[model samples]
Target: MAAPGFLEADGRNMSRATVLMLMAPFFALVIFAFLYPLANLLSISVLEPQPTLEHYQRVAENPVYARVLFRTLQIALLVSLLSLALSLPVAVLMANSRGPKAIFLTACILLPFWSSVLVRTAAWAILLQRNGIINQTLQFIGITDEPVRLLYTQGAVVVAMTHVLMPFMVLPIYGALRNIPADYSRAAAICGAGPLRTFWEVTLPLAMPGIIGGFILVFLTALGYFITPALLGSPQEMMIATLISQQMRENLDWPFAAALVGVLTLIVTVITLAFSKVFRFERMLGGRV
Candidate 1:
């Protein structure tokens, strides 16, 4: 017969083992679906007819490819900034308001998410095209003598991307704001703090984790984006995604396209890791670590 304490310890160990057994399938799926495919793609970049540094050299040395990479970064930065700026106020309003106002705002935020991204991009293309609705409306109002070129421009691409990505920025910020306790602001007011001061000093700092999270999500997603830029942009505005497509489809260069994919993946992975580190720091400072 076992001592009571010895039996209790055995039961605890079995419970821990059971938990691991339950988690095994999830870990296996992640390895197979995510890591394996990514490893295969990265291999394509280097595994040529023979192992080569040539593709990476071509990407770095060629002015055209370098310019395209630079353009993609620029566009991603602009979209991320614009998305953050636009999302903040909407997030604040949703957090503060109640009743019908809150319901309407939340619905508006989620409306775009329910629709297909492809459909949204196509709609923007029609709206912004030279002979499309926006141009026609402007011409009809005598705002311009001619239909101004709007579609197939970098500006149009940014505008459409910002629209699609705005929801991503807003949701996280709202979550952060809602998590902030109400009494902190009330106590500040009681202590003679103005509303603006209280918000700036207390509310903003507390909600920063969410803001940073939203920024990273929007920035990374925008970086890998393909369809919006492809449809809404010109050759001069071509992003990395379009370049990869051109290589694979038109140039019939799978290895080179894979190299482009590898570069993009590396950049995104680094950015995500950096963001995760920053988030951990923020959480520690906020006492939530």
Candidate 2:
């Protein structure tokens, strides 16, 4: 038989054990579902064709893969920048407004997310097709006499991607802006800084973390985006993701495909770490503010 104190301790231990047991499924899911596959891909990249470095050497030597990788980074960077430009004003408007107006503005930004990605891409395709509604409307309104080619281009991909990614950019920045004290702006005004100056100096600095976070988020996601670019862009504008799919499916080269995945993973990790380091430095400067 146990003493009263011993019994209570045992009960507490059991309770803690029960909580941990409840969380085991999540741990297992991450380990098996996500981590296992990643490990397999990494191993496959190196171990294929008798554990040689030939695949990586080929990737480095080949201009086609190099070009696709470059194009992917370029497109991703462009999309992120465009998303930032479009999201800042919207986030500011939402962060400042209140009640029904703020709600309406927020809904407008979030409404597109409720729909399917395929649905959104299809809609854009229809709108941008040579004889689609946009061209027809343009002709009707006398913007252009002839239907112009718009369906498959780099610009079309960027526009559709920006539309999809805008909310990711907006929400983080909005949260950052909302957290900033109104007093900062008030003080700026007292110090003789006009609205533009206040924005450029005081507000923008404080909001940098969120803007950086949003940019990184959109930028990284755009890097792996297959469907949007596949649908909206042509072969000349093909991205790394599409190339990876082509390698695995069309070419039936698992080793090379795995190498592509490995390279992409490395690139993403480097970029994310670089951004995280920047964020941490800014936080040090911020100091509990």
Candidate 3:
């Protein structure tokens, strides 16, 4: 009895409602798994043990906590920068190359994703040991006669973290580079720009979004990184995450641990918002707001 247009409109409304129905589970999961837990933790930090800001105040006032936080930031920054430096040229190469080389390179980059982080950290532990391959290689190459104590240092932590986080940096950059048009490079060449000049001007600027994305990804992931650093780093290099775990599990100071978690969450939120404000994350991902 309804007009044809009216039936089509009804069908569209049903389709929209169906889509919402499909999405309902995902929203429910987020609420239960992420938001609810975070809210509970934050509330515990403030409300547990007679409702106090004392937990937060202790974290701020303690020099050890302050040092650990600062050290965590330092290590994260170092790993992010190192990953970016190593990723860019590889990303460019992957975007430009073809045949088996590209496939092989991509597999090499992606293969690590299939492995567990614990396994990777264990491998690094073996390789960087006093008599391990790297030290032996160094000895063979006359870099050092005896083992140089490489296993449990800040440098070792950064090296392992960079390797683990490198894929994150490379993939975003590769995606960004792949999205850039070939004509842009060609146009620069036609405009009498050399290869390096064209890259420095056209390619680099165009790829900034990806670079920024990769940097943030690597940086943020490195911030709370626990396994690699815990395995590789010494007590002197203990990061905020390590401290938080100790507080929660070893010390059994739930309220203080909750407070540390709150602080870390706040820092992460502020950094994420700051980065989003400074850069167009959607633009980098080739999308529009």
Q: For each candidate, what TM-score against the reference?
A: 0.89, 0.88, 0.92
Candidate maximizing lDDT? 3
List ranges where model 1 is wrong by over 4 Å. Answer: 1-22, 281-289
RMSD (Cα, Å) of model 1: 4.2
Q: lDDT tens digits, residues 1-289, model 2?
A: 6334433454554454555777899999999998899899878879977888889988899998899999999999999999999999999999899999999998998898899888999999999999899999999999999999998999999999999989999988888888889999999999999999999999898888788888888999999998999899898889999888888899999888889988999999999888777676444222234
Q: Give the TM-score of candidate 2.
A: 0.88
Q: What does the lDDT come to for candidate 1?
A: 0.87
Count of clashes, each model = 0, 0, 0
For candidate 3, the per-residue lDDT at 133 reads: 97
**TM-score pick, better of 2 and 3:** 3
Cα lDDT tens digits for candidate 3, 231-272: 999988898888888888899998999999899999899999
* TM-score, candidate number 1: 0.89
Q: Per-residue CA lDDT of candidate 1, range 26-76, in tens?
A: 999999999899788778878875799788989998999989988988998
Per-model lDDT: 0.87, 0.88, 0.89
- After TM-score superposition, the amount by which residue 243's alpha carbon in candidate 1 deviates from its true location, in angstroms, is 0.7
Better candidate number, 1 or 3, judged by lDDT: 3
Clashing pairs in 1: none
